[model samples]
Target: MRLQTAVLLALTLLVGAGVADRALAWPPDLMPADALPLKVALRAEAPAPKAKVSPVTGPAAACCAVLELRQYTLKPGQRDALIDLFDRYFRTGQEAAGLRVVGQFRDLDDPDRFVWLRGFPDMSARATGLAAFYGGPVWQAYREAANATMLDSDNVLLLRPAIAGSGFADVTPVPPPVMPSPAPLPPAPLPPGAPPAGHGMLVATLYYPFPAHDAAAAQDLADAFARDGAPVLVAAGGPVLAAFVTNPEPNNFPRLPVREGEAVFITFQAFADAAAYDRYRAHVGTPWWRGHVLKGAPEVRRLAPTSGSRWQGPF
Candidate 1:
């Protein structure tokens, strides 16, 4: 399929028909000003055109571009100010540059952090649009006004679509149907707060290096996470999430906008409910978590939102 056709199809499936055309402003009121900025671009080339696959299989070619910005810590009561800044600067700027503002989120567990994802057509357009916007008088004025309160610099990441049905389209191209699996009976509801069955949790430990860790140390950390059954998790906004770590790469997508020596680590886990999360937290205390995963790591941050909506980057 041609790139344009695939994009149209994916947009139809992801965003409702006509929704993408709707003129929406950047930085909806909910976002914060200090939010890091990400610039994502999708490849203009189409993946091999194949018969529509299962909805669960997701889209074939990448559809939207995603950019993310991160704010490490906010002032005592600057949430509203930050939100206003995001609206005035980042959101408005992106929209003016002709991009689609997809979603924005604040970490439920960490109010100090924020994330936003926006979409674009392709790489060349993205580059041209960004250069024009950043170099324009409007962005310059906004930048000056935003300078004083900016918590950290922004990081940009370019992304292509991964999962099927991940786009904002309405009429998705259905994939070839497969034999349905035998439906299994639902499990009995557990009493009050019992942990859900078959659910497991993996905590991501991000390592940011001060003076860039030696390749050996980096590999060791990666190997450790792999051995512990938690390989480095890569998601759309994976880079921003890694910002809480040390030694962030420029191209790391969805990363927080943090500086060196301010390195941080984020530990993540999955659980059925609060009880399960508590159990795991208790079982993995400072010593265990530190010694096992965070050994040699400087700063550590942990968050687990009850709902996926809380932390708005890549899943």
Candidate 2:
């Protein structure tokens, strides 16, 4: 669910604005919309991944039992302002409302795109939590200022860990009591050369399989990643921080709509730097799962976390 409401919910996205500016091998299509086997949201059928790892323990272990992967499209040059307001005012308030702040990020490839993750213990918690946050004082005070800086905020995905031990770790479920007074608007940018925000190296690889031919095919591919692909990912450079599959649950909060009918296997990884990420990219020239999946490669996002994000990487 969105941490804050957009002030301008009625505005439509400019075609030349974002989604299309990115190159291929990205989601929502860098190629023509019809090129990929996974079209718009459709029923995705896959079993729980069989491969198991130790469950990730943190303050919000159950908080991330279900998750929201939100990507926002901002007006020109408004990204940083939104980031400032978001980093300063969003997390703690949302968490206090019984939701969890997972991580917040800047889409390294898209200047106008803001990506983030938040979660709840389960579907019931999600409904109760979202009602509290959106209906609470913090959002009401800053909603307009926060909304003024946006063009869109509806690109969202509902997800859960693909297997045990594959959800984000170190998430804080709530913050100590504090007032909702927002800091002055248009907050300052980080000092030049201050230690970069959390290594600034998170990559999300999203897999969109062709509609499941067999009930087991999708799960088989996910299982293959655990058995065969994850090990190679760690050895080459980055470590797989978490892995997620589409949360098949019905949308509990109708206020924020997630991408529907879409089945995706998303993985989060951390690298030392772009050089480290590039090295792994080059190493995967012949992907570990190349001959395994019938569909082409998945889309990738090179994301840098905001200063306030707890997911500052190397996790």
Q: Report, for all candidates in order, the number of backbone clashes.
A: 42, 6
lDDT of 2 by residue, 1-315 (tens): 110111011000110111112221211212335554322211154322221111123222323689889989999888877777777777877877767777888888998998999877789989988887887777886788789888888888898866554566546547643435543344345444432354457788888777733324555556667766765665565566677788888898898888887677777877667887898887765676787655567878889888788676533
Tens-digit lDDT track of model 1 for 1-315: 233232322333222111222222212222237654221222344232232221212323333433322333554444344445554345545555665444343444566554444455555555555565565555565564444454644633233332222333211232222212232222233235422121222233345333353434443443333333222221111111111122233432222332432333333333334455455545543432334433455433333222222122122
Best by lDDT: 2
- The collision pairs in model 2 are 7-147, 41-260, 41-261, 41-262, 42-261, 42-262
TM-scores of the candidates are: 0.39, 0.73
Candidate of highest TM-score? 2
